[model samples]
Target chain A: MKARVTVSLKPGVLDPQGRAILHALEGLGFSGVTDVRVGKLIELELAEGTPLETVEEMGRRLLANTVIENFRVEPA
Target chain B: MKSGVVVFPGSNCDRDLMVALELVTGTRPVALWHAEAEVPAGLDLIALPGGFSHGDYLRSGAIAARAPVMRAVADHAGRGGLVLGICNGFQVLTEAGLLPGALMRNAGLDFICRDVALEVVTTDSAFTRGYRPGETITVPVAHHDGNFQADAETLDRLEQQGQVAFRYAGEVNGSARRIAGILNDRRNVLGLMPHPERCVEEAHGNLDGRRLFAGLVSVLA
Candidate 1:
């Protein structure tokens, strides 16, 4: 089994990289782009019996920093 | 005072920190590898030097924070041992949950490397006791993700508790309230983006950074 973790900066946290990308997109003639927030996708391969709790623990411990980012796990 | 310096792979400043510690404490600190699960006994201070730990994989300091030695550093901190984290070390501290807030990419989207002016916001903590409150000093900072961010509530709590130890005198990075350094709630741990160990000698252009280590040694001794 494989799990994909999507880690995103929390709301109200400034995403400078996202902002820069948004600016670049606007400069390239793309409009109506209100905002852009960048995040990370971490793919994990685990044994079939791996529990969701164990995956969540991995997120808490190393996959995501709860201080500035939140993460959600999905079966891939 | 017995001190230890945690050396993770790619830690370029470990020797600098060791030299500074030896200069002030008159004893070379033990170089503890990142794989070590324990810090040596009878340590008064543990210094986390700056470098691109784990090549800034995932995020700056994210991987290194989960290294085995950090657990020992956290435990030592819990025992009231003083911990000083500089530059990348600061990021590791935040990632390790030993400090609040996280260092984000600089708002300008550029890597800043230079001497930055900082004001001592709180002289009460062991890390800032050598300087007077409101005094401005220059320290060298070299980081791409030095912009510090946290929730409004945590920022307010840091302010209310006087855990904010240093604030930038000028806009160097888009840090909240221009925070350059901060102390843990217990006041024993300090994390800052500037490299104090880089300026601990007269040959280093300025000696303003020396007082920080001097103060630590004085207080701990």
Candidate 2:
């Protein structure tokens, strides 16, 4: 089984990289870009019987810093 | 006092921390690798030096925080051992849950590298004992992500407990409350974005940072 984690900065947290990307998009003449919040998508290859709780623990322990970021796990 | 400096793969300031420790304590600090599961016994302090650990992959200090050595550092702190984290080390300490708050990218989105004026906010902690409260000193801060942020409640508690050790005297980063350094709830651990080790000697242009290490000696003695 594969687990995919999408990590994003929490609401109200500043995203400097995302802002830079948004600016770059505007510079490229792209329109209708309201906002951009950068995030990371990490794909994990887990053992067949690995529980969701285990994966969530991984997210809490190392994958995402709960202080400023949030993460969700998706089955793939 | 016996001290140790945790060295991750990309850590560049381990030697500098070791030198600082040697100069202040008159003893060489052990260089513990990130792969190690335990710090050596009988350590008075554990210093996490600055660098782009794990090349800042995933996130700044994110990967290195999960390294084996950090587990030991956390345990050591739990046992009341003094832990001092600087620059990227501050990021790692926050990631490891040893300190409160997160270091976001600078509000200006620039990699700031220069001497920044900092005011001593709390002189009661072991880390800031040598400096008088409200005294301003210049220390070099070199980092892209040093803006500290925390929830309002935590910030209030930190202030009430006098855990805010140092604050930027002027606008340097977009840190909440202008916090440049902070002490943990237990007050034995300190995490700061500035490079005190770099400014320890007068020949290095200023010795303003020396009192921090000197204070540590007095506290731990």
Tens-digit per-residue lDDT, B1-221, candidate 1: 88999999888899999998898778889999999997789999998999999999988999999899998999999999999999889999999999999999999999999999999999998789999889999999999999999888989999999999999999988999899889999999999999988898878989888899888878878
CA lDDT of every candidate: 0.92, 0.91
**lDDT of candidate 1 at residue B157, scale 0 to 100:** 96
Instruction: List TM-score per model, in order.
Output: 0.97, 0.94
| Per-residue accuracy of model 1 over A1-76 as CA lDDT, tens digit each | 9999999998878889999999999999999999999999999999998998899999998888888899999889
- Supply DockQ values for each candidate: 0.88, 0.70
lDDT of 2 by residue, B36-101 (tens): 997789998999999999999877898998899988998999999999999999999999889999
User: How close is each model in CA RMSD to the real structure?
Assistant: 1.0, 1.6
Q: How many residue pairs clash in each candidate?
A: 0, 0
lDDT at B117 for candidate 2?
93
> Candidate 1, after superposition: displacement of residue B136 in Å?
0.4
